[model samples]
Target: MKKEYMAFLCIVAFLCIAALLLTGCARTPEADIVTRKNTEALTDKAAGGTENRKSLAENRKQTPEHYSWKYNNDAETLQISADADILLPECEAVPMYRLSSGGFTQEQVTGLYDYLFQGRETYRVEEGGLTKSECEKQIVRLRKQLEELEQQEQGDGQGDDDWFPDDEREYLQGILDERLAMYGDLPEVSQDKKIAVDSTLMEQTGIDEREDGRTYEETTHSLECQTDEGDSLYVESGSVDTSEFSLLSYQRPGRYTYSSGIAVPVDPGNADEKKSENLPCTYQDARALADGAVQAAGITAEITQVELLEGLAENGEDGVSSERSGMYSAFQFQYTRTFEGISVATTASEYVNEEEFSLMWPYEKLRIVVSEVGIQEMEWEAPVSVVETVEKDVPVLSFADAAAVFEELTPLSYEGKIEKLSQGETDASMDIHVDAVRLELMRVKNDGSKREGLYVPAWVFYGTESSTVYTSDSGSAEETWSETEPTPWIVLAVNAVDGTVIDQVEGY
Candidate 1:
């Protein structure tokens, strides 16, 4: 019995210890359980809170067609509606607080109207509401107002830098004043009389046309007319009295008729006379005749000044040959005339020793002076050929041959220093000088296959102390040579397929 009792006690103690250990492992802390339960409750409340509440009014408002909602104060409910054809009832104007229900507020309605109807021509006001003249006047007024506002914005203390300079502003004002003065006035200037001289008629007056129908060669007289204003006009009205002037024909030393049908007369006696005569005009006889004709025509003209211009020799003193030889002469005569308080100057030039002996006189300049009452004088240097020579050794090249050679040799990439020392042509050959040349070749492959080649020609120039290289590629490669050296370098050719180099030459 004692043994049984001891064993039983040991078992009981072991069972008790086991129970305590299990209880200790299975039980959670009170504080942790409270924390977990509280958290779960808060999450539940949050999930079911105000955010989950949906009203019919709000739902209707979310639809685009309905797109409207209103709060009813009397009914304490929100109402909403939507449909494609539905129209909201228009609200009467009311205080902000009173508009707590129905339709939109004034501001909201205005915004809606603006959003829907802005920039659309469907809503037009009225036609002919403003006349064009009234509109223009309003525009001018608005512009003036805008200008004033701008001036005010710039401030009074600002300088006149914003406006035109004084001289320009004054000029503009004067122009405006002149324009205003012309508003109701006749044109201030008269149209100019442009008389086109008939060259055929004028040619009939020349000594060469004496055999023509007109008997200008048989009479020698002058006519004068007096204008109503007491102005006198003189005209050469008489014929050339050829019967009194007998032909004293004498052969001249230098006289010759050219194949061009021009007759040039040179008499030894006349040559001595010409030598004795002052450089340009042999006598004042021509001027006297002109004056007499003017007096006969009743045109008031006074000779104010006369000048003699020298002639240029057909060949230079050394007689060097040139292309310009015998083309023109340098001798001329200038005369100034005053008429109707206007001073006009004119020049008459004679081309002598040329195949064609030509004479040119200025009549337009004289007319302009007479009309404008202003002194107008013009002087020009006549071009004369002093030398006559043919260049014997000048080189010439055909365009096609030059282009072909340029295309062929330009592709060869030569390696060396290049200096353009000289370029010249001889009668037979053209000469080109280059100091150095360089060329490089590059092989390129595409898609793991060698399809194209690249050529680069580079040149170093001694004159410019620079170097340049040109690249040429396959398919699209072209060869070009240029006299002007490239800086750094330029791509001369590009390959269309496989992008391979064809030719490249560099120059320095």
Candidate 2:
């Protein structure tokens, strides 16, 4: 009797416990979902399952064929029309890479030389600036000019301020006397002597030891050759720093003018005639050649932008228009680095504080100008060596979300321009037309160091902006002036992970 009673109590206790669990489980749908999710997660972990992770990885690999979206503001101040293929990493997660200063190896430098110069013989040129005879002729011409000016001053008895001023007369006389005296002392012009370029001779030209125990060295080599068409080609290749941040440049001084901000062929004498003719090569052909050259150098880059080098008709202060210029002298191409099949966007404007401008860090770039003669100019600066992957995969926000951020910040981005337009006009309106949106890697500086940076995914908008201003003379025919910029202008860049607006000039 005692055993049976104990068994009955035990059964009752078990039933009561079961009933309590059932009552607790009778929760709202939200609570039930949470419980179920927690159970499934635990079950998954116990079963050694990673289905969720695998699914995310798989999703990242799936790329869409194209991307399209349209948005317009209520006031029509901003409009976006996007119908472009997704030219970015299709993966849901992207790996960030650490970059350090790097440059080319000897083999790579030789490969570059072979690709550019090939079988052509190279020469060492000492530029003969203004031959001795040229100097004598200049001195004679200046003396004649001074004599004429003196005669004019004596005959006219006027200051001639409208033409040459009194200061100019003295300056011309000084220049003439100096040149006449220095003619006999002028050094003989050096001749262009034939020479051999030893690609292996990469001599260390400079070394800098920093306080941080970092030693940076600059090694350089140069080769000069005359083209088959009698044009001169000067090639300078070098590396700066430990891993060798490399540079390879090509120049044709006679054919093109080069500056830090521009690379254009010297204006042809028959520019007006060439204006109607086609370029030396089709853009397709030039692109192909450019691609081949890049490949030869063993560079991983994507061509981001291309522009035609055309001449402009300058309007002089005298209100006369100069001769209209040519169709295209060269095709300019810009390339950015790529990692894991994704390329970096060239939209970021380099940021350097006024105090640090002199010691600013160099960024990576590859710009080439292809002309009729061939690749007239190329600049590849500050190549990087990937140290390690920061993350195997980092989840990023959707394009829609990123575009929303762009919309929110568009006004702020052009706020200054809009305010300026509003001034001096009774009415002013700005219309920003965004045409292309690309997901590309952006170089964000690492914490506390300008020398290091991490490449993260970003959405960059490309389009044009037009602003129209009107003047009202009491409604007597409102004067309307409108300005339209060229297309493919970098509108803005947004961080895909955190939706932060990135200022290209500031480089956040």
- The per-candidate count of clashes, in order, stands at 55, 5
Query: What lDDT tens digits, residue by residue, belong to model 2 across residues 128-184?
Result: 455567687788778778788778778865845577558778899888887777778
Q: lDDT (CA) for every model shown?
A: 0.24, 0.57
Error of 1 at 251 (Å): 22
> TM-score, each model?
0.14, 0.63
Work out how many backbone clashes candidate 2 has.
Answer: 5
Best by lDDT: 2
Regions more than 4 Å wrong, model 1: 1-283, 290-298, 313-333, 340-363, 366-508
RMSD of every candidate to native, in Å, equals 50.9, 15.7
lDDT over C-alpha atoms for residue 381 of model 2: 68
| Per-residue accuracy of model 1 over 1-508 as CA lDDT, tens digit each | 3454344345434543554465656432211111111212322332221321222233224323312221222322111111112111121210000000111122322332222223222211123243444444455544555556566557862465665444444554565455444444433344333232110111123343332334333332222222222222222222212222111011111111111111122232342243323223233443443343333323344442232222222355334333232321111122233322322222221211111221111121111111011111112111111121121111111112222222222222121122121123101111122221111111111111111111111111111112232334455664333333311122222111111122221100
